[model samples]
Target: MATIRALVPTQLERRMKTPAFGRRALLAGFGIGALGALTGCRAEGFAPSAVPNGNIGSNLNIYTWGDYSDPANLEEFGRQGVQVQTDSFASNEELIAKLGATRGTSGYDIVVPTSTYLTLMSKNGLLEKLDLGKIPNLANLDPEFQDSIADPQNAYAVCKNWGTTGFLYDSTVINRPMNSWADFLEAAQNEASNNVSLLEDPAEIAVIYLAAKGYDPLSTDPKIVAECADYLTNQLAPHVRAFSSTPQNFIIQGSMTLVHAFNGDARRGYLEAENPERWKWVFPTPTANRWMDTWAIPVGVQHPDAAYAFINFMLQPDQALKDVDYIGYSTGLTGQRELAEAAGLKMLDVLFPPAEILDRLVSLEITEASGAWVDMYGAMQAKAGA
Candidate 1:
């Protein structure tokens, strides 16, 4: 695995300025840099010996979203004999780019990509087929996450965590009954104007207008894409305060009154706020995107044994519960709600929505036309001066 021992403070500072690295730095409480700088450090009296080619080694490397993994869990895994290293990426595009550039020889044993990208990555020969027999805890997953559209046979990936895209607001600032995306729009234009924020993700931002208008948020038709792009650039962009994916800091600082955010981040913001009651998290009416991130081994995995071991280890209920508490997302394990509440998870309703809300959530798929959505998003951002 690549080490960061040669990275000076100046080099680390420059990397932290990029959107991908910056988001990870912020979410991990700036520990990502510290971890990178100290990559050579190991647990007391522990030194993993290198293994020969095509053989299992006492090392596992991961590429995932920032702050998605808990340090305590990793330490426990280390105690079991394998040493682990992790790196972060901000978006799926960045993940694909780096892995593609290396032709899957990036030396990363485990990667966490959204379910929508699983099929695409597998088709490109960037991922390896999973050995289901090695992951006995696979049965612990909720049936709903099994036989997924992205990997029907659990061939390449297994769901790690799932969350929905939604908006959050400070009820104290916009004190009206808010329930739907329509209400979100009204508040953004009126009370929350010049102080509203939307996610930096183009597909996520497009969903807001597409779903509110009762259209398929994933539609890639040229006309629909153009229409959504026009409306976002002309009607909505002016009211947006900023484009960001990490809104927890702004929410706690009271810098942005309303923000389009993911469920886990929104919950973290609400819970961390001084007056938690003032923050309101909404599922939004009509529809929203429900995304799932999964664990998959890259084609050039050097430590298949360690990769399988870590996956099985994380799926256990005890370890899964710790992940839920640290990351604030559901693990899709059976009876997760009861387990979470038994462990004293605050605001159970926010993390686990009611059945009606759950029914309205939709998973996104990647198509050839997905590139057009990216182009349309670029146009919207350029026009909005964002």
Candidate 2:
């Protein structure tokens, strides 16, 4: 295990900006001095026309994935009179479970959830339908994110960021070409055990095995699910160093040479690490899970008005650009799309990927019975620990 050290934000930023250090390596192709400048289109300034009062007060509470947003967004919101409070969760299941447990009293005004959870939350009446009219910035969004499956008709959520789940590795550390799940498993067992980590999410773990087995990533049949569970418990579990919800730390500290990660995160790590030569990311061939995450106001939010105001603020092209630069995920803001692409692979293309790669992307078709992933993940952790 790697001992954790605390670094101030400035220290971390300085590290990430250095060519030999962090994100600078990922920028080798573009050679851009500043990422925020990547948004090629004119950034129309933000004006609160939709809200008559904007009496939303100075406080806004947000629940989101850990380390997912730009602190600059918080500063911008503060300038606009909204004090932002952000809480994070490890998985979508955690987000839904929290909201489900609290119901009307979830206390969170805004939450960033992926497409599936947004749809589920909407259907369960746990999300507030947006008055799209209030958010003129919606026009700035790419058509693909508008009126999405997660919030059909653009009813509840606004597009946040999107990416794919894969893994990043230290090529020099492993000293081998890891192209597919088969290679990943073999390396974990032989060269990388106790030095590699897999995703803590069972849906992702299942996708890895299912892809190796040539089954659909989102198979609904219980039998296929069972096979996935069997592979996870009987094979992958013993070799995995740990099941990490935020596995990027494994790559950062060099405790784990190979790590299951989201493409954006791997890219982020590559840009932030000491050894750029050691870092590499791959979307397992044949297929990978493509994901879209969105920001939504939870139903019965205490600061609904402020939530609207804050979201509108984020949707602005300039603000969205800062987020993509900081977070390394692709956004659907129309003005920022070209800029994001210019930011290059590991940033945009790898997150959104090219059209040919898009056909290989699969979305998880989870159902109520998907609780099995949660239990299985827990069991695997316990077994690994033992």
Q: Count clashes in each candidate, considering only residues at least 3 apart in sequence or on different chains.
A: 0, 4
| Clashing residue pairs for model 2 | 22-271, 22-272, 23-271, 23-272
TM-score for each prediction? 0.86, 0.80
**1-386 in candidate 2: lDDT tens per residue?**
11111111233323233232211122221122212211122224535437775455667788776666788777666665566777766445456657776776888898888786675577676788888887787788888667765567888888888778777877876787778877777776677776767765567777788887888776767888787887777777877767665566666676777788888777766666777668777777778877788889887799877787778878888788888888777777775657765655344555556777767787675563355555566567666623
Candidate 2, RMSD to the unseen true structure: 10.4
Candidate closest to the true structure, highest TM-score:
1
Model 1: per-residue Cα lDDT over 1-386, one tens digit each: 23222221343334344563322224533222324311223345322222233133567888888778778788777665566888877666557667877886888889988888887788777889988877888899998888898899899998899888888888889998888888887898888887888776667777887888888877878788878878888777777767776777677777888888888888888888877787888999899988888989998898887788778878888888899999888888999999998989998887887889989988888654455555555555555534
